[model samples]
Target chain A: MRREGSAFQGVGAVFIKELSDNISSVRMLMLELLIVLTAMAALYEAIIALRQNTAEDPFLLLRLFTVSQAPLPSFVAVLGFLIPLMAIGLGFDLINSEHNRRTLSRILAQPIYRDALLLGKYLAGLATIAISLTALWLLVIGLGLIFLGVPPGGEEIARSLAFLVIAIFYAGVWLSLAMLLSIVFRSPATAALVALGIWLFLTVLWPMLAPAFAQMISPPDPRYAALGLDTPDTAIWTQLLQRFSPNDLFGEAMLAVLSPTTRTLGPVFLDQLRGAVMGAPLPFGESVMIAWPQTVGLIACTIVLFVAGYILFQRQEVRA
Target chain B: MSDQKPEGGAASPDVVIAARDLTKRYGKTSVVDAINFDIAKGEVFGLLGPNGAGKTTTILMMLGLTEISAGRVSVLGFDPARSPLQVKRRVGYLPDAVGFYDHLTAVENLAYAAKLMGLSMAERSQRIVAALSRVRLLDVANKRVATFSRGMRQRLGLAEVIVKRAEIAILDEPTSGLDPQATLEFLDLIRELKAEGVSVLLSSHMLDQVQRVCDRVALFRTGKIVMMGSVAELAVQVLGAGFVVEVEADGAGIARRLAAIPGVGNVETLAEDRFRMTADRDVRPDAARAVVAANGALRRLSVDEPSLEAIYAHYFQASQSGGVRDAA
Candidate 1:
């Protein structure tokens, strides 16, 4: 069908409006402040924790993210817990509020197609996430400089930026999932609760359940049990099942980006480790390759959830 | 009461909107069952019906918001279902309950609408001012719409409609839940739009409301137009050459005595001292003689046709007797 305007004509308008709304909203402010305060505390603890591991450091800036003091998790772990909340907070009311306030029909009556509206909302959400993540990152870097009294090398900065991008991509999956729920459920409370339930299941319950599930699928070999050793096959299947969780993909990508000495994320046999020097850093490009599939998984999940939301929203009746 | 094609359209007064056997079905139920009509340029056409009479559904179909299950609707020479963008860009809609971004200022809301309409920054500011001033909202342009009253929101909605500069404005129950003054203002705004040659299609359940502004109207019942024409045409069709006489003759039994007359058919008593009588034949003289002969001094009398409500009731009864289920 021939359309009047370009497919993306109204996307820019919606993006600008939504971005301003997100940034100026009190909810985002509270969430950002929480993330920033936790980041500052975690970075401060990391500074004290990583003081002695200065010899032969290639990606030293990333140490700020992985190192932690007692009673406080690492910066990466804090982000893993906080980013989903921030993303869900931003998205849980995005579409349902339009319905509740009865503005959806008025907006849809405009000259643009449904494609622009959904795309615009998603892009605005991604932009907000990027801005908040970038600010938090710069704060961490600045804190590292003050406490450690040394600027990070270029390689460290590059690796840290890559980790930041991967983190944002991971958050996008939850954001898209939250938005899909928002479109599906008319009540914001229900949407937020369902999204949080899924997140909790995937992050906390899925890891414990995956082993039992994988054992049912591929149980340990009885012949290997006769040799007084459990088979690697069970571990391999459990790891494979665990990888389906976005949290695991995020953790794997974070490890590859922050610690170059880490070679493989999945099950690795001793034969594959031949001639590999322990604690030797891989090149920057190879580190990206190692983490590429995890990043792609996060991105693919985001796209799948967004497409589902878009289709449902488009098929809905505008009368309401 | 005559529904002549309205005048003052600078553009061609040809059909701006046309429907042919347009039907909308949900599963097996047809909500808008095979409706057909044409709205000319600058014409103020009314879709007059009570609630659940398919007025809103027909408007949705015409605007291409609802899918047409069968047949077609053409708005400005384009099939709305096929090219809805083109149709919507030129059509402005005021829904039953208008909504706006309450957190945004009035100007901000209109500016957003202008941006979606492809206006530039310079054009947006210029048109927003012009549109708001036209709707008498320029003084409160910078105020947040949350603080605005319902009438103000409705006016802002009209401003947004005008800022788009659409050729057609479709209003669904625009004056619902408004005070009489606000309703009059809303009607005046519609008249201004009509004067500017915008094809106006509004739906209402109020006969007087439609008769005041609409050039022509279609009375709908159960998703069908039971009778469609100007107010005069409907009155003539239902009450052909009938004279309804209201007589103020002081008596306790004027209504019964009027019904006992030779030609009077529909007798409604305004009071014990007043009676309203309608008849196919001329019964004014006989009615006056009967009143005076009843030893009741005739204080006042007037011979006029029945109101549109009475005509509607007649058509409603006609449709019910024809085995159409409760088409009122």
Candidate 2:
């Protein structure tokens, strides 16, 4: 009877078991629902504020819902930061905890391949993030309709969904990174620390420090520096520094979300400074393409890290 | 048990698991080196050794968890290195210090393992019940494993492995933490599997348990199998050459006189008036007559064959000396 099923069916069975086990836990369900509810409330309050104001600018509401009159940069900024933490939190102990429980070898002894174990964990983590983010997005859209007197247009909906995908992929990258660390390190606490440290370096410290470090170490060649203090060369160097960070990719993604017209940094920054910001909304597809390089880089890194982890785990002896 | 002969041979069935010149090295030190042996189908094979004697390393190589540095291993007609999934599917393993999800109930843990083994919902439920019942833990199937006692967890671990009805069960110290009663029950469960034609390769430090259950045992020391064969066979071939004679004699006075005899190797006073005489040859008759002639009345007379424990000690001593000789 066991021989009748395909390999993928076996993998799917394990994946579903892991997913159900994770979601069925009271603590995990409460934590995820709380996050979704908080994001919904925040989105609803912004939409309500926009509706009460009688502003003439057509984008006054969009800007208010996204960027302007907020506690921080934008809704995207909050999501960009919070989503990765959620991803890491969900996956940091996925593999190591199995080892700790002494069930890793027992599970591997079954017919399932090592790939199944890793893929099951990855899918479970991604599914949790997707479900939470979807719930939040739906609530926000529902609130937007209730408060703003109308539903989002086709382009607005597409742009918001695109942002959500970017957020999901960003979270997935962190999840893979955390799982890789979990396999490499023995202790769950240590794995979490390593994952959080990488997150902090990429999101907070790298953006601030990479530019300074590049300037100090290899300040644009004097020949290029002398042409102008703030030429395209300087902007190129700054962007190059920003390119080293996943957060910069997220920040660019957020900019594309809040003001659709702001696709490229040169035009976006120039328009913002000159107070000549075009009212034309950028297409969601174009915005995603602009962040495609960082997205690809992060996704590729995730694959490499996870494959290394898989190999290490396959080679590790479960003696203890 | 049905006396069906395996396809290979009756004396030594086709090797279900074979390791030849197998070696595993961690960096500079070899944990298992050139260890050669075979395990036959339906036989309860034991890998017996003291701690750090490479028993676990050999098992890990068989499971393909640890890469072999040299030599080769074939498990059930599949190369463990190349076809690990195939080999693993046919083998159930309980690692040392078996641990399961503390948050999950025993039934859930077994069901998860069964699903991993590709069992359907109905099959999983039936197998889980059967396995738990075999391990005598069906009553606590619904309770979370975190609250289980050590012995209960061990039993649950056993249930998880057998739930799939794997062809070969590899257990590493399955009864290490079990109490005497649990150990006996676990041995009975193993015996049941043997009756059902399932092969078992158990590694353990508990020599007495291994001696009782294993049809054959491989004694490992310092990364190699120094001795390997059936316990009865080994005792007969190695220690069986000598006979132990217990007789009521004049304590140390008779013991010293027996030691001086031509064929007798040594004699020690066991109790108040009894003496145990070990002879290089079968000199029990002559020694008994000698004791009777020397003002001694034989209260009890018996010629004893060497036991598994004595053979184990003998082989370990020989292996240690062999290792030292090789070093020199």
Candidate 3:
């Protein structure tokens, strides 16, 4: 039978409530603190390195995210590592906590379908990540201006903003993954542990293991190895394997956006670089075009994960 | 209480909820087998049964929170499965062990429900305060629910229903886990709801408490309703001998004289001065008159009223003995 009325009738209410709950939650606060401190430490190290170099590059502002001192990573690298953690923290308990608290049935009894609650919660998680990422982005820019004593060019500003948006999408991927786990596991602790385990495997193990796995599947050509050239088939296979991890997609997308000279994220043939200027930076639009596939990949991963969670939650019984 | 009950047939306008052949099944096992009942407007109907007796399953089916394997249920004239939002808009449900967000204040929690109900900001605050006051939770409106007791949380749940201004309230084991005083207080709130013309359908395993507030009750056994009607009617049906009258008196041959009264049967002497008998009707006046005429000193005379507890026990005992006495 057809259900009457819009399923989104209570979306606004659920969204507002979840947004406030996420922002005020103690776990969220701790995660936010960790992200800010680590990002600032990286940013400080980047500024020190940039100050010592006195580089005259036109994209010097963009270097704030990529430059690093010894024993410390760059601002973008720190964010790439921490964004997923924050997203998981925000969503690992999103649905199961309601079940544990015995409130799911009561809430579902309201004049709204499950669609509204799940959608609202996912949107709220995305919004929370967006707000924090934007704030952190602006803080970095402000610090760059004060410490470097140079105004950022319009392209640099545009590129960093693009990076900020990509970072939020990156967070959405992990948030959706965590929410899916929350729906699958009844215990919040179990969901959290499993989400963290997947995050570790994708971010740490996958990148290192992708090349070995790809080579095993498609051995490198002897002719290419003897000529001191990368094999085309193995490179393509490795890139495909790495693309399965959201971390790889997000990292590649950020790299393309923040470093305009980057033309491709995969292994390059000498012929592909022929006739290109040795160090000329691509235009802002061209950089975006280069990152477009990865950005879309991040968004697609988020949607697929969220849809999986939605289906599972819809079929779940409301009884505690 | 509305004495005019809408018997099994097409629903009357007075009926706020009607279930016809309502059934719920999991795989091959039917949890609720073709049970039918009606809740009239401004009346308190009870679904009484032990745990796992399909009471909760029936409640869930009515709210459309779970899939109905077969048959249909209408709440507020809308089929719950087809138009759940419409039915839910007018019906408030408090699931067993009703829960609230402990971190949120009572007002904040109720406000969320109010927003879900689409109440405007101005009306939301007004209704929230009014609901809290009605449930006697106004004093703790700003206190986090974690600091509140279980009874307070249950009251807060009731307040949420009040905020919705629902036409019908469905409570599943609302009084469970509450102290005797709290249970009484909660029942009073339910009575107040009935007084305000809100229909209530409450399910519970605690028979005595349900007997106190329910206008009519359906006794659920296994997946079917074994017996149903007002407490008095069920007593007459299950306990065919009817009312149990007790007399504390002093006289010669009082038991034999009490047995001679019209509509009285099976008089037995408990003590030299006490007697108990089964009567089809209230034989108190007749017994008193007979005792006075027989020159016996009448000290006390009372009847053991028909209680859901007795009816539930008698019906279950009879069924357990392999005598399936069908009384509905």
Candidate 4:
């Protein structure tokens, strides 16, 4: 083994080791098995709905695979809520568990940088989520084609793929955040709880409270506000308040993906088709770009948290 | 490996690790204060000390695992603080408690470590087998570590450290939890490491093990090396010219006469006839003549050098009485 090998190879090695270990874990296998069984049940239910003709929309059958999405908003809301929890669970203990096993010192004694450990664990988590999500997506699409007697149109296919990527990136953001938490906290249990608490706060409670909290903190004036005219001052303040929540960014990305008419408030890429054009739906690549800033922001936040954790880990004394 | 001479020195034997003024402090208290030492290639160097004596702290600094408050450390010609990656590549460290994934088998644990060390597939297999064999754990290589006894875990820990064939091995209390048989086996493996010219720094409170395996030992007390030298040299220094002479005297009056001798400091009667005397130097001949002149019979004359345990006790007592001043 020459020392001249690229440092990325070290990260690749760790990634492979983590991925193999994850697949071999009984707990992970059980979870995947349960997911597969659930998908089968959902498929059977979708087929029954299609045969009965009681269901007005056939696309509503996809809801059986996950939660009920009778209202379109409910579908977005359910996925938005569930994805972060899964992400947090997948990555909450990746680093701290190694520390608990006392293998951290030994692994670090190798000739690789500390960044490799963080990046490898992140990549492994991302890969696992991607594979699992892709499998489920294919299973649902397969069931849809067979039961509904309708192969998804190109637009629907495009939307599903776009949704899958968004879901993955959403999960990835949480995974990275959880990994960062794992590095910051010494105990795996504490890291998991903190990550879960953060997930619940952001996905469930924060959105519910943000508007009320914003109104209370910065009340709108009744005199001019009653004129039914929107003020730039109030609009800027509201936008600032909304940015405080990660859900807003995720919601914007989801809206851009699900609704053909919706466009993100940014300069449209003239060279490339921006958002989903009426006739020519948004391609997967174009969709990713529209959501690019949010993805990058989430990824950057993950990196910053991880970098801080890495610095702390490097400085920690491995006494026992 | 080629035998190239190290720069800035004669083609002397390779010194795998060296520390000059190596110091570590925790806030106001200095744990390891300005200690100078060098580990010669292939020698088993022991840092012998009581608890709270900063042995572990010193080892951590050498491994680049702890921040050095002051001083310099070089392992395998690489400065630990500046070039930690290079230092880590050539060094294998076994911390005090050798914890591992209990669910993983011995072979799996070693394989994981080997992979982390970037060993190739063929090299990993070879090294894993060799390490397991070296530690005498080859039979239980497939057994999960959770099922292993403490002694077995210690052996596995040793196996992991040597799996990389590192040039310098830093083991902190490597055999602390082992039984006599396992301890001996572990010592034998250490001896083998010495034969391969791998420098080993073993931190232990086991005086007997240190005496047997270490060529040179440093006795640390209150975050400082109170005494350091080869075992023989230490024995010579602590024991000095020594012997005790006990004479069977007539009565208390004769004991007084023996004490009155210019060379003898204090005298006491052991029984109805026997008396003991303390001498500042080897005054055996003079004391014997004096006893004879007083018609006292010499019952026993023996030379007693202080044991390593006694030397350790004496130095610790001296250090305490010296008002716990910091050591250089």
Number of the predicted model whose TM-score against the real structure is largest: 3
Query: Clashing residue pairs in candidate 4, if any?
Result: none
Question: How big is the positional error of residue A28 in model 4, measured in Å on the Cα after superposition?
Answer: 2.2
Candidate 1 runs further than 4 Å off:
A2-4, A52-56, A221-230, B1-13, B239-306, B312-328
Query: For model 3, how does the per-residue alpha-carbon lDDT over A1-320 read when each residue is reduced to its tens digit?
Result: 45678989999899999999889989889998999999999999898888899758898889999987879988888898999999999999999998999999999999999999999999999999999999998999999899998999999999999998899899999999999999999999999999999999999999999999999999999999999977899999999999999998988998899998898888887899999997789999999999999999999999999999999998898887
Residue range A242-305, candidate 4, lDDT tens digits: 6555666777776666554444543234555544355444455666577777766666665676
Rank candidates by lDDT, best first.
3, 1, 2, 4
Which residue ranges in model 4 land beyond 4 Å of their true spot?
A: A1-9, A30-76, A221-243, A264-290, B1-12, B26-29, B239-306, B324-328
Provide all candidates' interface root-mean-square deviations. Answer: 5.4, 5.7, 4.3, 4.3
* Best prediction by lDDT: 3
Question: TM-scores across all candidates?
Answer: 0.88, 0.84, 0.95, 0.80
The fraction of reference interface contacts (C-alpha pairs within 8 A across chains A and B) present in each candidate is 0.60, 0.73, 0.94, 0.55
Mark the 10 consecutive residues where model 2 chain A has the least summed lDDT. Answer: A1-10
The residue-by-residue lDDT of candidate 3 on B1-328, one tens digit each, is 1112334433788888888898988999998999988888899999988899999888887787889998877777676777778778888989899889899999999999989988899999999999999999899899999999889889999998999999999999999999999999999999999999999998999889888999999988889987888888888899886688999887787888888888876888888899999987888899998888888999999988877777778878878776544432
What local lDDT does model 1 show for residue B193? 97
As a whole number from 0 to 100, the lDDT of residue B173 in candidate 1 is 85
Q: TM-score (0 to 1) for chain A, all models? A: 0.95, 0.83, 0.97, 0.75
> What C-alpha lDDT values do all the predictions have?
0.85, 0.75, 0.89, 0.72
- Pick out the ten consecutive residues of candidate 3 chain B with the lowest summed lDDT: B1-10
Instruction: Kindly give the number of clashing pairs for every candidate.
Output: 0, 1, 0, 0
